[model samples]
Target: MNEKAWENFIVKNQVSKDIPEDIVMSWKRSVRAGIRPDLKKAPQILNHQDIQHIASTNLLHRIFSQLSGEMEKYFNKYDISLSLADEEGRIIASFVEGQLKETLQEIRFYEGGHWNESKSGTNAIGTALAADKAIVIKGAQHFCENWHPFSCAGVPIRHPLNQKIAGILDLTSVNELFPDNALSLTAVFVQSMESLWHAELLQDTEKIRQEFKTYLKNIKEDDVLAVDSSGGIVDKFTKGSNQDIEHLIPLTLRNLKKGENKEEIPLENGTDVKGRIIPVKRNGRMVGGITHIRKERSLGAFRQEQNSDSPFSRLIGQNDNWKQVIESAKRVAARNMPVLVTGESGTGKELIAQAIHEASDRKNHTFLAVNCASLNHELAASELFGYAPGAFTGALKTGKKGWFEAADGGTLFLDEISEMPSSIQAMLLRVLQEKQVIRIGEHTPRSVNVRIIAASNRDLKEWIQAGKFRSDLYFRLNVGRLHLPSLHERKTDIPVLANHILKNIDNQFQIDACAMEVLQNYSWPGNVRELQNAIEYAVLYARDRVIKEHDLPGDLLNNENQRYSMGLHLVSNEKNRQSKETKISEEDQLLKTIEACRFNMTQASKELGISRSTLYRRLKKYELQV
Candidate 1:
């Protein structure tokens, strides 16, 4: 605390002489870069008064309310007070020993004060956010010399999946401690705060993702679209299918000169996707495009995209493989042969199966689904083959109809077919070959006209080789094969699926570019099902009507793969087309208009402010309502 000691400390580090004037300037620049830029109204405030008001807002109130009991226990152990800040760097929560209460309140610190490098030079809270990590600013390290008298350390709090910061946890005091111990203590405290934040994010992940799915449809991004290298229209946003925004216009994307300007690629679809396709280098050699998408959006502009409908309807997006699956489904449906569908969990194998059934000649007939995995050996056999009256202990008097019989003149979908016992497999193989089945305890076999669609997440052939699945049955059902691409394989479809689901919940789910990219970049190991579940989650947690990148599951957003940083490029053209025109924001709205006139494109066109070409374009673009 003395001048002599301060000089000694400076000298010991060699910071007084080794640092050049330019390096000093660069350090100042780095400090500026480390500060997180504050937004207007929400991120920006008129002054400390406004920040204090926000600190007292309901959002802060609830957060503090939840932490009160737990925080008390934590503070007692560390002998440290707790402080809370809103996203705007306003102090919302502060606690110390009862004796120091007056001093705490008397402090000039309130809310809405800037801690970002751009505003305050270099400090803990602002720098942590800009750096997106934990940091310490002890005494002299403080950005503003006035803050030097005290030592402060803060860490960024986020969901384990890395969703968003609820706030920050900081330790500040005049107490002196060994530097080595100090870092560890700060880490411990910050981690505890992060633990609390992560728990909340995980609990809310699904809710928020779902809410975001639907809510993003209403987001108003100046220029947002899915684009590839050089910025061609991979996809675009539209209000109504009938609106002629320009069909599949492919625009070339070029890089902007390096420096301050960000490159925005324009799409023929009349939208913008932001990012640059710079050389991605591993060890000096070029890899590919290093693209980026922004997650931040204006709150007011966000609510405009909210819509309400079933979450399932929003599953439209295109990938070559997905399209191949669709075309294969049509072919499989047209044939009378048994079809086997395979994919990892959540790839929508069942949906593809249903599509095949719907596209078949027997579209009008009933389609029954039975999960082979859910039935026991005896029950399973009886369930598939049917049981005659008095056939077993619990047999119905009239004899229950087998799935084959119940599904006569229609289609029978057996899910998880790999789980079927050898006995059941034999029975199923017979039905496939002869088209006949006899109820349990029945003497005669009755002919049935039913199509069979078998699906599983496992590789049936591999199982058969392992002796778990019957080779004969696998061969019978494998007459036609279809593989559903994993979510990662069809990363391009994320925005489409998100939009599709969101459109069902609410017609206004306009996806912001950053949010869309986050969805696209996620590894999606749980596949489509996981993506769907996450969307369902986001829906519940989203605050505004739009889905922000922050609403995504922490795991998906973490960029653990880091592949996204390079994989994402300008989809600016597609994004621009999304906001160009057309009014109906929800998929159901489009479907409703279609059904009102019996799916007649002409009638729907007039109602939807689009042309027949646009209608057809949409049908293809969104893979609309079957």
Candidate 2:
């Protein structure tokens, strides 16, 4: 139904047959809650601290960590945004993709926003929580006019142990028509989340058991008990009766907070026992606790070790060739000689240059990168060298400092050096030789001490032979040369590189063996940059933060398949060549027989033991007109 029908129902208090019963009931409840039909957005009830507290909850953290990747996939594929709301309808987290972010943000559909029926109106998150089931609210089915343009499907997620409504999982879209399977998909998602919740509980229990075992090694206590987060007993070791330990369990659970707490409990046998209960935590959330009757010293504070690796450590690779290149770069960083970095496109030439600058004594100064290929031909000279005041038309009145002057006392990275104009190359060579710069329209040369690091993906020797690059300038920059190998040349480093990229994006993310195998087998034409891009793409589409072969980019898989098919084609071509050779030998035999028979078809066919029609067919096959 259209907005007109919705307005009719709101103004006349008449329910339309087109509206579902659940929606009609929600509309009545919304009116009774004193919700305004023109409410612009949901009320935000949580601040930064509140949101942080909600996010720190173990259950919420586990749910988001497990489902966010799949939610991202759905959003990317279907243009849908997913959200999780607490039992009270306060938005806890949201996974949004596509251009609907602005629209959703306009309505305050984000973390800390309250969307209960009383606060906002009839909507998926609110109404589903109210109904305690899965539901779909499409365009104009909402009680608020502001939400009428959106369609949403929501399912309530229940706690695995208690079976109480924990939160609502919602799928929202700005499309004109709601997805027919949106409700069912949401239901399935909730089911998966519920299963994950159960799995998390079991995992937490197992972790608590392990922690207790570690504690058991030190503790000389005769009575000990392990309890989960819910105060349920997991395991117990008792030398005496179990009744005294049972009485201490509740007292231990009562003071179960952070750190260790000692509790004194009086048993029914008129004996008092002293025990210490330590809470076990995972990801900053308490999972379970261990209680034992023992006297122990206070725990020592933990100190984290600082990383002492040099700046070059950022360049991640384990290949022997790559390590050799890095070692050479490190050695070159000690000297102030001109360095030239050469590599194929996307092979991280710029990264090596940056690493050199950061490792040098001039690291504290500015490190400027200029793409010679992107520099305008007309302005190339002016951009590299400072321009005098009123140097030319549209020149800055203040006399702009070029990259060389700007990067003085530091390092200047000239990328795509082969693409630089010949005139600029002459100027660059002069700067390198003279240790100074002469700005355009100025006679007095400026004495600058700037280190140069030039990089190119093309072979400078070829460019010099072609007369495209100046050989003198090449010699000046080639004092300390480092050539980076392509990704294909270092196949063994793919897994480590992929894992490092994944760790930077999300530490919880992991690459499956199949996905890593696909990456290792593929030829990385685009090199490291392409590998990073592929990892990021897989991270976005992966499920449960586990990247699989199917989650990799289509181009990577297609190229791998194409390479395999090309190998098969090569083998088939070899077979065809052998078959053609055999046919040529047979043709030679037929020709000799015909010659021996004096060009008689009947004689040739009879001697060859074949019919005249067969002889004619053989001749046609070999294109022998005679």
Candidate 3:
């Protein structure tokens, strides 16, 4: 069936004979579950501990170790991702390649994401689990609109002993179609894993039995039990047939599955007991666990200490380039020297400077920020350096301490340093070299111990070449340097930054997946500041506290729509002569724009009113190099 048929089924509950019976049933089940058609991503229902438990399972660890190389080959050959999810549909492991890894992560297809039908709607993984068989879900067959651009196949892996479903082996393709052998390949992998699991269980059960005997001799006055991988009791040692100890078995299994090695279990008799579980492993695969139970000690109550905030805690970024910048800042923060931070406006230069100050020895002292660009040309010296009594007109009779002296034994941040007057730059250089500030119209110089952090959006090297800034001052300030990446250059951080912004506004507010996609695709010209404003605007207009696509600013939507239109136009005008002439002019314009932006794709795309992808395509068509 096509999109229209799918729409009819969803809107009117009318199923066509052309649609597969399994898909129809899945659709009905999804509707009954109250799954929204526009759901953007799978819910993340598992935490780090839960994922660790699944990953450490004997059977899964073996499967992953054995098949990782083969999975990588398949991913390289087919450009698809291979994922393993537990019976509950929580993804435990995924094998993906390069940029596709980030793309899939955006849709919550990574480890710890829940893909059960109740959570993620109708898809290969969920539908295959529901049917207890292999299935392929193609575009339009998926119940959720956000999943309509991809195709997926899933095969349920069954436990060898019980023939019951244990997990799922899935292959997903973003090209809207998979090879005919995709499902067969998934089944083959599952069959191999099950076969390996059967052999390992038979061999490990005997090893566990041998290991359990040694543990029994060491325990005295305490109950010890040996449990199989599935928590089935294999043997027990106790002073008597203690019924209360059996009650502890359930609690022990629960804690083990949560990846906890030790836990306090309170008995029905109001007696507290402590249980310690030690795993019995053969060849890196867990065979069973040895549980030791003893009376709890009457120790004082203890609480974990809260961690103190780091100076970089306020900085939010996960991109590799951004992380490197932060790391460099951290290294320089311990040294006593002048630092120069350079980046585009709104790229958090001042934040970095502040972080450096907070991380340094002078953090407890004053931290003063002066905007050199805003300083008056005539009064710049007087503002930066103190003036003696009756030094000039309107001067205070008692004299005044300038910013340099006021910020002594602390850090002083100078923003837009390139905009400082030429004479003031000379004075700043003198202060840095002499470690003293000479007051205006004063013979004596006052010693001031201060660390300087300078920031500028313009290229100071270019300004120096233009005779607008002093080379000596630039060199002194550049003792330590950091350049922050723009928001567009670090799009991977958009989701994190947006979520942080939302939490700051209201804990209940959230952004829809579709809205997040829009935010990620937009070339943010104003960097983090622009993103903050956009999120604030979205929250104000959001419905039901969820920021959907319609709630975004009109400019954001218009830009996306314009890019979509241009993409279509490019496809349709592939052969027209008039379009060829237009293309020639467009190619020249793109080249000029790239040169003007210094080969930075983000800025070039923003200036040209096109998406980065569109710009890349145009560059390829014209055979132009960056």
Candidate 4:
């Protein structure tokens, strides 16, 4: 049925009794959630920090990485998009192309956003996860009024061994047409990922068994024991009758600190025992400890003490320039003041923002991040401050909580703050000043307690001069300013970052010294993000599990000859190389914009930040056409 007919059906039947059985059931579920039809926006319940913690450590991410390219190809062909979400219904990753991507972003269908039945109402991913089964929800089947224009199919991916839902694989399209066999295709893909994950888990189990065997050889004492990170004995080697050893030793050797490791105890068997503890450390973390039990001995001295794992530990850099930024960030983390992080594009600004959030007192609370560059002025206002019921066309009938309200007792990291429209900047400044937010179509201002951490790749000062940013807002956000160095300035961290990325892949994926040198030599304009993409690409396509210099992207290497043939000058000088790289970046961005806009000149030109005449001239110069 058309959208108007569906709206009429909803208006005619408040109880939705005439609606399809599945849709009616979903609508009842939403109604029970206290969701009304006039809710304008969905609350951003999950934060980026939670999303990152899941994505970085989950096995599903690795499996999805392998399938993303193929899925992207399929979705692009059908003008649809694919998204992967954890079992909690938080979107972890998404793949979209063309104008459809832009449209999806307008409705907050991006990574880190929650899509559970309660948050997003009836939708494919949310409903599939809620029901623990595959389902298709077309236009008007959705409970949320805002999602009436989109059609989607979803399948829950379960663990192969445990048969428990691991995540959901979903396909969404703006078009209302029913997709041919889309549900079956999604199920097949999810099954393949499950199989791959099962194999990897088996390999990990075998590897752990081998490591345990090696650990047994290192024990020299008969009364010695090996325990896991949780202080449970994994294996024990006992030679003589040490019946008292069980009662003598501590049940769990988890709380002994260095320089304070003395334990003298009298057992119930009338035996006195003293033990020396030697901690087991792997990758600088105390995973377990070794205990030596004695019938009668003096307390042993404790050696060095190590700090517990801190969020700053994940920053992963030793360079002084990089460390300075981290140190500055840590100092202000306790202040609970607004922070502004500035850096070049792909220079790890978002990472720094996350690190700051992790280091702060509000770390235990939600740490939501929203890309200001992705939202226009009106959308940004509603998304950041929320809206009343019936705020605008296609808005949900139930009033919704935005990021600031959702993160009331937490922190909000606004990425690309410089790209935020001037009008929204003024409102944001007011929010910071008054610690309150007024939703759209509402006159009452609600008090909120949210810490602001804003990041920008662009210079806000320049934006202010260009009349695109507010100077007063800049002053408010710049209270804790941090400037992150580009990757080229901190080349020493490249090898470490590369190793970290490679560890996510299988053992077969190897990078040699030659490849490392090539990576270090090239000027990484895109910084760590570009390096990560290169590693991902290499891992995905590497033959025989080895990544060589040949497998690296051509642009990363100094290949001026290729540029010369492409109607661009070949430059050998370092300065010239930098300039040429900028030109190449511009051209690549232009082409990407054109493709994403579906070759629409007007949209492409606007997105490229160039005039139509300039875009046309460049298109002709590159021998391209619409």
Local error of candidate 2 at residue 548 (angstroms): 0.9
Model 3 — which ten-residue stretch has the worst lDDT?
Answer: 299-308
Q: Each candidate's lDDT (Cα)?
A: 0.57, 0.79, 0.79, 0.70
How good is model 4 by TM-score? 0.46
- The candidate that wins on TM-score is 4
Candidate 2 residue-wise lDDT at 212: 73
Report the C-alpha lDDT of model 4 over 412-467, residue by residue, as the tens digit. 88998888877888899999999999999999999988999998888778888999
Off by over 4 Å in 4: 1-308, 558-626
TM-score preference between candidates 1 and 4, better one:
4
lDDT of 3 by residue, 407-463 (tens): 877789999999999989999999999999988889999988899999999989899
Model 4 residue 430 lDDT score: 95
Return model 3's CA RMSD, one decimal: 33.8
